[model samples]
Target: MRTVRYSNREELEGINSRPFLANHLRTEVAVHLHSNAEPSHNARGARVIVQPGRPADARLAQSVLCSMKELIHSVSVYADFTVAPAPHTGNKGENREAKMPSIIVETAFHTNPDDARALQDPVFRTASMKGVEKGYRLFSEGKDCVPLKAEPIDGIHLSAGGSQQVDVAFEGNPQYPIELVTTNVGCPPGWTCTDGRVRIETPDTKPSQLTLRCENAGSAPMFWNTQVVDDDGVKSPPVRHWVQCIRGPGGAVASPGVPAGVEAATAG
Candidate 1:
């Protein structure tokens, strides 16, 4: 095997050198190993970053994540997507520009003392290599890497006529994006749903579906049920969420202009 290295701060100059290595030598896949930093000092876990919608890349990422999870035994790990968009541009330059399917392996958070210690262990790195091996085997044979499913995620609250974001958890390799459809028949006027698909950037994270809005509040609570459809045309059982505009201290529905203190209260 041949090894190539990038100079420090090469990215600062807009230089992506990893592609040159792959072009010069015939390679199957490229793996970029790295780490992440969280705002919270206690955040911990390992996640693989891959190009979205690429089955082989996704499988490889899932494999690394599952393997690392077993090795750490304590920290949670999952596969994440490296989507091409602003801020992230989907992923690091190495993965996006490579000649072959590529992914970035975020070992763990250095800010977390526990993870920092884990990063120093030779066994930890070994586990990562093993994970890649496992994924490579499946990817080569066109095996199923991740199971498919749609998971309703935490709901966001909004005042009547206001908008809020809805999201879902996705699993498995999908040839298409996850579609969200409102199943509630009583969705009142001003009720509109947009951005009907789950936009995922990584694994172990929820994908935003769309904004839910209502034109007005009712004397009673309003209900909404959503159907999540996966890439293979598989549909998840309807998931429910709701919102009520509070009129006063009690749980009564309020008029459009009533002040919603919303104390210790959550709206679906």
Candidate 2:
């Protein structure tokens, strides 16, 4: 069981390199993990994709999705919590021209509040990976699953060239070396306002707080990906909290824009 990373910085930078490296290494199968989204923010649940006319790819896709189906829980009011009826067919740059079987797993929709909350839970991360392991013990598995909840922060409006202290709080028996990251989505094009990564110095299991700085150089929104990582290197699912950076005058950097409904602390 080998792991492959297509890009760093939580952004899609080296996508085409996936199939290239897989073919170069002569890997037997390829699996891509991803979260889904849509403009409506109503879509939820997990699904898989494969290249058309490939039997091996189809089987691998089904095998993994079946396992994920059992582990992930749906938050959709419409009862859409299972994998798609069949593997979706596509010729994406990451899957096309691969000499071996390949499949892409859409874990869940980050656009939905319930699904997004589940994605950040450590228990959900562990269980989802276990499902993938079972799927692979047999190709891999998907996440609206949660055992830990990170308080949600949104509607955070900031001014260009202004900075704010973001306090991220969550509930769980967290292990040491927790890592908070920012995903590729949400930030404006060519903007580098995200803090990128921050480490929790304390190892408290309850009422933990992670404070970091987020400065805006452009007018756009940002989503911070928060996760708990044990010393063993296992990572919890990411909790993506949103912030809005605005470009205008009269906005103060020191005046915090802490939104309502979130339990957060301000760094003095």
The whole-model lDDT of each prediction reads 0.52, 0.58
Assess candidate 2 and give its lDDT. 0.58
Relative to the unseen true structure, what is the C-alpha lDDT of residue 196 in candidate 2, on a scale of 0 to 100? 47
Task: List residue ranges in candidate 2 displaced over 4 A.
Answer: 1-13, 73-80, 139-268
TM-score of each: 0.42, 0.44
- Tens-digit lDDT track for model 2 on 1-268? 8988754534444666888899999987878888888888778777788888888788777766655654443222323455675688887766776789888887778998877876787766655665555565454222222234466644456554444565666654333566555443454555443244456656653444443333433455666666655433444567766667676543222222233233222222
Clashes of 2: 1
Q: In order, how many clashes per candidate? A: 6, 1
As for candidate 1, its clashing pairs are: 79-203, 80-202, 80-203, 81-202, 83-90, 247-254
Name the TM-score of candidate 1.
0.42
